[model samples]
Target chain A: MDIFDGIATGFATAATAQNLLYVFIGVLIGTVIGVLPGLGPSATIALLLPLTYTLEPATAVIMLAGIYYGSMYGGTITSVLLRLPGEAASVVTSIDGYEMARQGRAGAALGISAVGSFIGGMVAVVGLMLLAPTLADIAVGVGPPEFVALAVLGLLLVTYLGTRHPFKSLAMAGIGLLLATVGQDPITGATRFTFGQLSLIDGFDFVAIAMGLFGVGEILHAIEQDQAVKALTSKVRNIWPTRQDFRDSAAPIARGSVLGFLIGVLPGGGGVVSSLASYGAEKKLSRNGRHEFGKGAIEGVAGPETANNASSTSAFVPLLTLGLPSNVVLALIFGALTIQGITPGPTLIDDHPDIFWGVIASMVIGNVILLILNVPLVGVFVQLLRVRPGILGAFALLITMAGVYSINNDLNDMWVVLGFGVLGWLMKKTGFEPGPLVLAFVLGPILEGSFRQSMLLSDGSLGIFVQRPVAGVVFGLIAVFLVWSTVMALRGRLTSGAEMIEHAAADEAELEALRSPAAPEQDRADADGGGDARATTRTTTRSRHEEED
Target chain B: MSQHAYRFGALAILALGAAAALGAVQLGLGGLSAPGSGLWPFITALVIIFCGLVLIVEDTPDDYETWTRRSGKVGIAFVALGVFIPVLQLLGIILAAFLLLTFWIRFLSREPWRLTLVLAVAGSVGLYLVFGQFLEVPFPVGIIGRQTGLEFGL
Candidate 1:
């Protein structure tokens, strides 16, 4: 059947009462978690993964997919109203979003964001429908050598795109790969790292590692900081933007949608990079001379918000088609699918058309649900921010421990969770990104299997990797990224060392601003239980200086 | 001496790599054509060692801090988790969860006693009913539950 026929079949399947309910619940939970600081989509998905065990694969994926994109919508609320980024992708949004709020145009900022997000998400879903099947069909011809190259390239790109410190990321990836070898060897049946324990025979549980790293680790970090967030007391007056606002944002939204979709297709270039790139592009392309780029510019809010949502939707392409997750969130989704006995790869589309198409259909439906939920119930979501971190952290810990144990009914898994939780906390303290490590861990066995298969096929010749055209190209890209990053790092150290220090100082100042009250009104608000108002003022002042610089 | 911490971390990684390499050698690294189980791990260990060497060279002095400042909270948290495992096996998920939550809320976060007690009891019992009774997950009844003749049928 054609793609349209498949999607239609998917819509029919997803239109069921049970499936629709799951979609609503997923998006609802997604928005809630997105609005709450310290609980990102990755952590939320990891925390809820075990519950999906009894669910049908399609329904489970549909719900998880909702959470992924629903967060994009939820993140904007805090950025606009509170000058706080709910997630990394929303960091850029706070620049202009909070400015708009300061100018009492918060409604316009949120309205444009919601509309832009809906459009971007819809476009990305269409792109996913068109691109994923074609990519899968093309990938069907891939040999083991190509698979190895692809996995390696994916690991490299994700590391490079996600962090400033590639070496540390690589080290984490290496550790993850090493950890993957803990179970019995796939080919030889020889145990490598189990140390003779029977439970070690099956290897470390994926759910336990994920829950520990993202969930428990995040909780520990949050507890140490103990920062209480204040909700916006000012009512969001206008939920709809004026014609002038729409007119200004039209091009930016369109450009952001396409840019975000393309970027999202790349490994490690999902939510964060897409929004940053979109913001840069919008800044460069804006023709309105009177409008300052970062000072409450509609394009600023529209572009990044749209792009992040679009990127999140399109990130599913690689995972669904090539069995490769482009980022950490997708890695968690991949884990969810694996636990459901569904291997996500090229064959996934052909084998489980219901799951593939049903998930895509659900994304489109999810966008509509998010828009409906967000535009009306935004105040309600803001109120949710009042729930104290202490209470939330306590319950979250209990749930994580219980949820992880349910995976295999093994107490040993709890040990794994606690161990990784400590490691994850240390990694956080030291500025090491756990994202690359988790992704590499998930992809490590596949990479190793493919590499060995290629070796065996070529009679153990290393030349087989470069001999294949696809593998050769992938390897070339990997080499280019490595060389380019090294050159960039060297150049940065030589030329921008002073500038980097200044940037760090400014970042410290910005953080300090967030912790204190900036203005008399804000001081009053803080005195009245508003927590910190200096964060908002500093954001505006800092952005102005950034514009000047 | 903050720079020494990075060097120390690098040294730790290098030591780990050396140990892994030693283990890999014992596992038997065959030739490339017909690889042994140890070949892949051995190569990974070498890569880790290279990374450690590079990290030592690139080490900056300001990265490390005294562990005592924040380590107290992390140490306590770790101790709580460590205590939890044996407690879970001995006392059951319900009692274990209650104790864990109470400790975290009461001691770690310093919430009020009434709030801590309410949350600890409600959270643990609610989770038990949801996960054990409704989801039908097989949870250990432990000495307390068994002694009380209270069994949750999975």
Candidate 2:
């Protein structure tokens, strides 16, 4: 369908009273939860998945899409005010955003962020409207081998690019794939690993596992942190950016929109990566140079906020066109659609125009709602941080249990939720991010099924993976990425060795400074508090090390 | 946790990889074209084993959060979650949630009894109104609901 017709159909379907109510609820809940530390879009969506079981597929997806991007907007509020990045994407924003708040420009910072995010989100929607149908058309004829390529590429991209520890991420992905193989064999109808249990016959319930890993796990972890959240409740004034602030931020807003849209289309390239990349670009290329960075720079906040929001919208392209979810949040959305018996792929637009178009239309409307709601209600949302973490965690835990139980009313699923929740907490404590694992679990079946089919089609010739043009190109790109990553790892190792030496010298210098009688008054006061100069030096050094990492 | 602790985690995953591979083998690994259920799993198990080995050998990443006395709260929290299932079966969701919320707020958060009671009561009723009454989620009626004849879910 053409863009205009599809959009018209979308608005017609999405503008219904029921759909509008859900859209508002989703974004509002998304923003509120996003303002709370440690409760991200993924967990919120997982907790709410049971509510979607009875809704129309289009409505469910529309609400989920709103939650996904709405959280992006909401995360910035905490990052700016409290410097307590609520979402990963807002971490960069915290640098300049918190500084702006300290400088009493919190209102201008938030105002510009909302305006930039709106523009970015709008640009991405237009891009999606223009690009998705064409991409879907191109992907319509792809077969099993091509599917294998896409799945592998998506998995590899996410693990390699989306994680700090590639080996750990890959191991987690392997575990996820193994878990996906727990039920009956797709082809032979032979139970692979059910252990003779009836509940195992369906393998693991996606909702249960998701709620466990993200929802329960995150709450368990969040409860470990200090519960006393110091709030910056000072009323923000000067709500609009001055003319000079607008002039400085205008170029960055435009640049970030385009940059984010392009990056978001790539597998594993949205959210934090897009925002960080935009921040880096602005820092290097801005006419103001680097002096203004980390000191209430309007461009720093404007660029990243726009980029992250834009990227969140554009990330939908892959899922809609190729049935490939680029990140963990998108994977949960994929699971939701699959539960509703709707497979997202090249034929989605043709098969379910309402779902495809209605969701896209809802995003445009949701962004408008976020802008309208955020500007005036930023103060209201910030108050959510005042709610005790224990109370919030208790409520979140209850919702998780009730939500998972509602799915099939099976007690076994609750056990799964508890077990995975523990595993998730352990993973977090051990420096393993569960994002790749969840994404891999969702993609596991497609990868295995297509891989087997491709082998059969080629009469057991493994070369079939590279014989098709699309698959061949994908494999070639994967090889290039592997080689490049290896080179970078080696370079990083060498540089880290030098960095370790520098750190040792800095530690020595810090110790000397602490011991010197001519030390600064603050250092003397700190020394007097403990009267253990080595201890003071050690604490400072450790914090500096953590900051550098 | 130290690097030694991470090594143990790697070893555990390595053991799991071995066990999964054995299970896959038992499931029967056919050829590439006409594969059995075990083929994909076996390959994945091998990849897992390889990753585990790499993690064991390489310098561990320094991103882990160090556990402190505060981590004991997580243990207490898990115990509460563990008790919830039986409580849910015995008293239905509303009472179970009330008790759980009260424990979390009054004990874990160290809040005043009045605030804990207020939040616990309000939260439980609100959850029931939404999940049981509105959404009809079919939660267990339990001993109390059955004796009182007060079923509230689909």
Candidate 3:
């Protein structure tokens, strides 16, 4: 059927009482998690993935999608009030948002951000409605060789765009591919790495690994750090923006929507890049130069906020049409879908029309819910930041352990969670990006199966990858990226050799300071302790500073 | 993470790769046209070994840091989780969860003993009711629950 009719069906399905309730709960949970420092969307979604097993596939997807975008809105509350960015995507927002709050225009800043987010999200959903079907239609004709190229390129882009240390990321990806080789092989049905364990014959459970890596691992890290969070005591009033504020933000919202949507479609380009780009664009595009850009310009808040929401919405494009998740959050969603026995690809639109359209339609409803939740319920969400991490961490651990075992009633799965949890914690401690590893783990089998199929089809000809026109272009792009990254890495090492040493030394000093017995109390006495804590966390974790580099 | 740790990690990874490669060889690497299951694993193992070698060569002294008392806390937490597996199999999920929460809350985080007991009981029992009774997850009752006839209705 046509796009409009499919969306209409989706709307009809999503409007059901149960689906709407799930949407509300999803966004509500999303906002709470986003408001709390150190709990990101990936961890929250991975933690909650097993709970969706009992629900219908479409409902599960709709709820998970809500959590993803709902976070975009929820992240703004902390950035504005406390200047403590709740997630990486909101780091840019904290600069101008906190400035606005300091000038007692916090209400106006939040109001404008909410409106901009709604507009950007709506526009991107409209783009999704128009573009997904066409892309999926074209993708239906893609062959095994082309798929091999696409998957490889996707893996490369995920590493290159998502991380600073491409070699490390590449290594993680290799490990992920090797991990996927466990259990029975799909092509030959031979057990490769189960180690005579009957439970692992089917392979490592994705939900278990995800819960371990993101949920349990994150909780352990947070407990180890025990970050000191200071609550903001600002009173929010007059959430409605003035006419002047609306006029200032109108052009920025429109520009950010378009720019963010386009950027979101690119691999490794999502909320973080789009928001930073939007801020830069607005700073450059400011006419007459009346408003100071850094010192609380409404455009600074409006542009990036709009762009992040728009980018988050449009990130669904690749996953829905090409079956490739360009970012970590999308990668988790990809896993969620796979667990439901639904493989996302070009034929997803035809094979699971309800799921494809329902999720798109849910985004529209989710944005509205987020806008409302951000405005009136901002106070409640801010209170969520006050809940002690110890309490939250305990419950989170319990839920993760229990939820993983419930997936297949296998106790072995719980062991996997614990094992990966330790691995994940170490990865975090040592400055490795788990995003590429997780993404590669999800995409590895697809890449392997397609590569083998293409080789067989071409009778062992390695040239088969470049023989097809589409595949050839993709491989060409991969080659270009590989060369570019290698040159960049080498040049970076040469030119910034001293700077690298200094950065490493600075990191060492910071760790020493953290280890000092009296440091925590002294830090709590500092006026900007929350911001400093957030900054230290960001610097220590490479994933959090992706926007800066 | 220190330079020594990096070297150790790299060596461990190299050992793993070597083992995997040996296993893959036994599985038989068929020709490219009709590839065996070992081909992909063997190739990936080589990549992993290459990464490990690079890491060993690239190790820098700047990466080293002295271990602190806080790291001991992290180790304690890890040990608590490790101990939880047998506890879960022996005492049932409800009681095991209670003990785990109590230890993490009271000892690791050093919260008030009163609040620890309250939350540990509430959190464990609440989770048991939700997952066991409400969601119908088959949580094992273990020997204690079985002998005492204290069924959780699973």
Point to the candidate with the largest DockQ.
Answer: 2
Query: How would you encode candidate 2's per-residue C-alpha lDDT over A352-382 as one tens digit per residue?
Result: 9999999999999999999999898898898
Q: What are the per-residue Cα lDDT tens digits for candidate 3 across A1-549? A: 898898997898788888899888888877777677656778888898999998888899889888877877887887788666666566567667877887888899888988999999999999999998999999888888988888788777666554444555667788888888899999889998888999789887778777887777777766666444564756677888999999999999999999989988876657766776787788778856557665678998899889988998898898999898877788888999998899999999988888999888888888889988888877778888766666777788888888888888878787888888888777655545566777778888888888889879999888998878999999999999778766766676521211221222223532332222322221110101011123223223322223223
Model 2 is docked with a DockQ of 0.62
Question: For model 2, how does the per-residue alpha-carbon lDDT over B1-154 read when each residue is reduced to its tens digit?
Answer: 6546657768877898999999999999999979998999999999999988877887364545678876899889998988998888888888898999999999998989999999999999999998898988788878867977877521
**Tens-place lDDT digits, model 1, residues A1-549:** 689988997898788998999999999988887777557777778788888897899998999889888888887898788766666577667777878888988889999999999999999999999999899999898889998888888787766555545566677778778888888999999988888898789887888788877778767665554444464645687979999999999989999999999988887668777887788788777655446765778888899899989999998998999898878888888999999888899998889999899999999899999999988888888887776666677787778888887878888778888888888777755645566778888998888888888888999899998889989988988888778768877776421211221222224543333232322111111100001111222233334434433
Give every candidate's TM-score on chain A: 0.90, 0.89, 0.89
Q: Chain B TM-score, candidate 2?
A: 0.86
TM-score of model 3 (CA atoms): 0.89
Of models 2 and 3, which has the larger TM-score?
A: 2
Q: Which residue pairs show collisions in model 1?
A: none
The C-alpha stretches of model 3 lying farther than 4 A from their native spots are A493-549, B1-3, B59-66, B89-91, B142-150
Q: Write down the worst ten-residue block by lDDT for model 1 chain B.
A: B61-70
Highest TM-score: give the candidate number. Answer: 2
Per-model TM against the reference: 0.89, 0.90, 0.89
Per lDDT, what order, best first? 2, 1, 3
Ranking by TM-score: 2, 1, 3
lDDT tens readout by residue for model 1, B27-91 = 88887888889888888788778877777787553333235544577678778888987898788
RMSD (CA, angstroms), candidate 1: 5.9
- Count of backbone collisions within predicted model 3: 0
